[model samples]
Target chain A: MICMNELQLTVDIYALVITTLTLVNAGAVYMIFYEMFKRFYGAKLKFETPVKNMMTLCGMEVTDEVKHLVPVSEIMVFTFRKAFKHITESLTSEFESKVLRDWFFYALIILTALIVLSLIMGWY
Target chain B: MTDLNLGIVLVSEVLIYPGLMFLVATIIFTQWLWRKIAARLGFRRGPMKTGPAGVLQPMADLLKLLSKEEVRTALSSKRLPALIAPLGIGALSTVLLTTPLAPLPIWSPFDSLVVLYLILWATVSIVILALSTPNPYTNIGVGRYLAFIVAAEPPFFISVLVPIILASRYYSDVNYSIYKTSLYSSSLWGLNPLTATLMLLSAFSGFISMMAVMNIKPFDAAEAETEIYWGIFTEFGGPRLALGMFISFAERVVLPLIYTFLFLGGSSPFTFTDNYLASLITTLIKFFVIFSILAIIDTLMPRFRPDQAVRFLIKYALTTAVIALIASITLTFIY
Candidate 1:
């Protein structure tokens, strides 16, 4: 069995470490989904021709009035393409990388190994 | 008639038939307390016809539950955990055997550490077993159970450590014999005021959090009534449900005893005079104090949504525990 003092210290460390890991897990999930949602919606909002027309006619300076009145449907096809492109770009760029996935899997493996080791040591 | 002598008598009484009776009485009392408190909160007198102060109401309820037709849902999970969950909870009530009531030891070969471990292990096992049942409603209830456990267990473990650490540090002799000694006379960290205060605070927070985590009202997301047909208990009925409720009452009984023993100076209070009787009285009083507060809370407060409840505990319960630990450590050096 682990020494009592050592076990106490280990438990304290374990609690802190797990709390950190859970927070990180929550953060990563939020960030990934947030980015996907933002990009998808951003592209959709830019789809209207009137929006593009206003952007072009006003060139550098469109009235806020015309901007609000312009229906996004006018830009549907272009915006749809843009949205699809953004979705594809985000998914491929964010998750398709070998290194990032490897890092995640490696971290998971390391954490599992550490927890198993601690439980084993503490259990006996 | 001295306090120390009375304590010895109380411990001895616990070793005999009286202790078992005490356990039964606690279950009955807790049920009664629940009803009365629940009624009072709603501006009504609860179960008055059952006897004076509705004392016999528990017996009536017990009989009804015992005779009620068993209703097993057609789609219920057919597994050992489902069968065993209530039994496990019942067994957990037995683990309460280690708790001292009225400053009296309930049994021999008492290992404080083991008792604490047993309580946690039993409760966790019961919870896991209960959550394994597979109705979609039960599934959500179990999710809430998991969330509550996650929120509550850390604070509990931390709180349990306070007294153990104090005992280890203050008393020159190790071996956990400090349970026999009076808190007032004990050298708890050599009489540091901060340590004393933090120890008290930690014990209180631990008590509250344990009550909440154990599915006592306001904190009872896993067993919310209107939301999920008694939440995780959606499927339990008849004798099985009775057993589960009994186990819950037993848990309620044991929690206060554990808290009292660890923090309020175990078994010494009733040992002051007429040892057995005094100890019994003290135990009943302490248990009632703890039970009544919880019952009142259950009646008065609205049940919280799981997420909101978790956040509330994080702020109130966890913060107090952190503060207590800090205070204890600071006092260990300065005083």
Candidate 2:
């Protein structure tokens, strides 16, 4: 049977670790988005020429998305779209490969377990 | 002893002096060795003329850095957290004081694990602050650094835990103080060949990965000069550069020392009649041995592309970490 003090210390350690991991992961996510934006700023675009006779701006690909997304007039709208894009890329591993991303997630899961265990078992 | 009285004395004498001195020594040693290694690799004598194989080279470099003019671009974000960057690094290094530098009972705090995580995040905070400096190269460097940190940290933490778990199961006392727990020669796997190999491999692999995380060599993409002009350090000059350099060196030596203490047999390698001096000498020797190996590798190997390097660690190095953990888990039942 554990004393209240030891149990409280264990709980406090868990809280500390989880909070730290969450913050670090948040930072990682922010960096991923930041890198995407930096790359987008420098990325080249390709366009197909449109005929004057065509009523539509066919093949022009002149949607707002074609332009830089960071400088949108409505900040919230831009953020939503950017966040969505980032999630899609991260999930599908479109930026890299799905397999590697899954493995990374597995490693994260194991790491989280280790941290929690350390806190509970008090492996200081 | 009263907790208040203990904390005060410990924070000042135990924390401040030795921690600061170690940081200074690490900076000096790393700089001198880096120059010597670079010169040797390039087939030139580096600083041999300065003082006995240029042992005083670090002192000269320190003076040079101090004498250089501190420059900040006029158009930069003047309201930015300039001091935060270096202060954060120094603070992060101070967290190492919580680690049992010697096997002394007084040194180990109750929340040592928490302190370790705090140290890492503090270092990352410094990285974020450095990135926020509005320098384009710095931003790119920070991006790469964040990715590496994300990729490397999970494996690093998990790997460290294997030894901890293996060591823990052998504890004779369920009421053992966390600091008194031993991993050395306890045979967490109890002489099982396969499990022993797995544990050793995990410990070794995790250690090398940590070295890479500390940016020792071939895995050093964040500040690869050819890829980006000194990487995140492109715009820093004068005292700020000096601080960054010091932080890097401190990180290099200290992280390796922690790894050595935790995983590489700790004080068992030396039977110190004079306990304090013996432990200190043991630590310094172990530190240099690890640093020299890294320096040689840095000279011998070519830097990897960021993407390729990330994949390689995830695929190969991390597998070894998993293997170690699994072996420990397996041995838990058998033993």
Identify the leading candidate in terms of TM-score: 2
Interface DockQ per candidate? 0.01, 0.03
Can you tell me which runs of candidate 2 are displaced by over 4 Å?
A1-124, B1-8, B14-17, B49-52, B74-82, B99-112, B172-195, B271-274, B330-335
lDDT of 1 by residue, B189-259 (tens): 23544455556557767976887767876778777777766766665654445555655666777766666
Candidate 2 colliding pairs: none
lDDT of 2 by residue, A1-124 (tens): 2221122235365445334433443333223322233244412322334421121112444332212212212422333344345556666756456544577557656754654464455443
Q: Give one digit per residue, the lDDT tens place, for model 2 in B39-86.
A: 898998888756777878887765555445444443334324334444
**Interface RMS for model 1:** 24.9
Instruction: Give the best candidate by DockQ.
Output: 2
